[model samples]
Target: MVRGKIQMKFIENESSRLVTFSKRKNGLLKKARELSVLCDAEVALIIFSQKGRLFQFSSSNMENTIEKYLEHGKEEETTTNNTEVQQHVQPLKHEGAFTAKKIEFFESSKRKLLGQDLGTCSVEELHDIHIQLENSLKTIRARKAELYKEDIKKSKAKEKFLFQENTRLRKQCGRKPNQTPEKQKEIASCSQRTVSLEVVTDLFIGLPPFQ
Candidate 1:
C-alpha cells in the first residue's frame, strides 16, 4: 500500500507534476483493477489531464459503477442522518412505545428527505412518497397530454385504414360481425372496476391520517 500524507501545495515545476501525475495514474489504475478482480468490486475513475482532457476507467461498466457509487453514498448519508436523529431523540427513549415509534417515524422521514435508505420506509413514509409521486405524475401527465394529440392523429389514420378494409370485407360477406351485448357489458364493467380500484387505492395510500 502506498500510504503517506503528502503536502498540498501545487508542484510549480510543470515537467515534474506531469511525470508524477502519469506515474500515480498508472498506480491508481493498477490498484483499482486489482481490488476489483480480488474482491469482486466495481471501480470507476474520472480524471482530467492538465490539458483539460477527460480520462476515465472502469472495472465493469462505467455507468453501473457510477450509479453504485451514488447509491452507496446515499446509504452512508442515510446512516449518518439516522445517527444524528438518534442523538436528538435519545431523551425520548424512555417514553412509551407509541412516542418512541413516532420519533422513529420522524427520523425515517429525515432520512427520506436526505434521499437515503428509502427502501426500508414504513407505510407512513410510503404515503409521503406517494404524494411526491403524484406531483411528479402530474408533471409527466401534462407532457404526455401534449404528445398525445399527435398520437391521436396517427391512431385515427390507422383506424380509418382499418375501417376501409372492414367495409370491403363486409361488402364481400354481405354481413356484419358484432360483439354480443353481454360480453361488451362485462368487459366495460371489468375495466371500470379496475380503474376505480386503482384510484381508490392511490387515494387510500396517500391519506393524511397515515402520514
Candidate 2:
C-alpha cells in the first residue's frame, strides 16, 4: 500500500525530540560512512544537539579535513574577490582615460582662444579662427560707429550754443541782426575810416605847439 506523506516538523515532546535526535544522528553517520566506502571519497559530517553535545564523523583525521575545507573555501573566496575587482577596475581605467583626454582638449581650446600656441594648427583650423575674428571685428566696428554718431550729436549741440552766444554778444554791441556777409564787410571798413580821422585830428593839434 502506498503510505501517506508525513508532515515534517520539530517533535514537541522533550522525550520524543531526544529520541529522534539520537536516531537521526546515528543514521546520518552511518550514511556518511557508506557513501565514503562506496564512492572512494573523503567524507566529514558534524552535528550539534539541543543540549550542546557534539557529534561528528570523518573518513580521515577530522581536524585536518575541516582545516583543508576551510582553506579551500578561503582560496576560492579570494580568487572571486580578485576577479570582481579586476572587472570593476578595467571600466574605471577606461573612464579615467576618457575624462583626461576631454580635459586636455578643453585646455587646448582655451589656449587657442587666448591667441597662444597657434604653430601646430592646421589650415582649416586657422581659417575657422579667422572667421571668428572677422565676426568679432564687425561687432567692434558697429559699436565704434554708434559711439561716433553720439559724439557728432554732442558736437552739433556745442556749436549751436556757441553760435547763439556770438549772436547775443553782437546784439549787445548794437550790431544789426541777420546782416549779410557783404554788409558786415562794409561796416568793418566804415569803423576803420572813423579811427583814421580821429588819429589825424590828434596829429594836427599836436603840430601847432611844435610850430
Q: Note the clash tally of each candidate.
A: 0, 0
RMSD of 1: 31.3
lDDT of 1 by residue, 93-165 (tens): 6566778789998897677766788787788977887788789789999999989988998987886677677
Error of 1 at 189 (Å): 99
**What would the TM-score be for candidate 2 when compared with the true structure?**
0.55
Clashing pairs in 2: none
**Cα RMSD (Å) per model?**
31.3, 13.9
Each candidate's TM vs. the true structure? Answer: 0.38, 0.55
Task: Assess candidate 1 and give its TM-score to the true structure.
Answer: 0.38
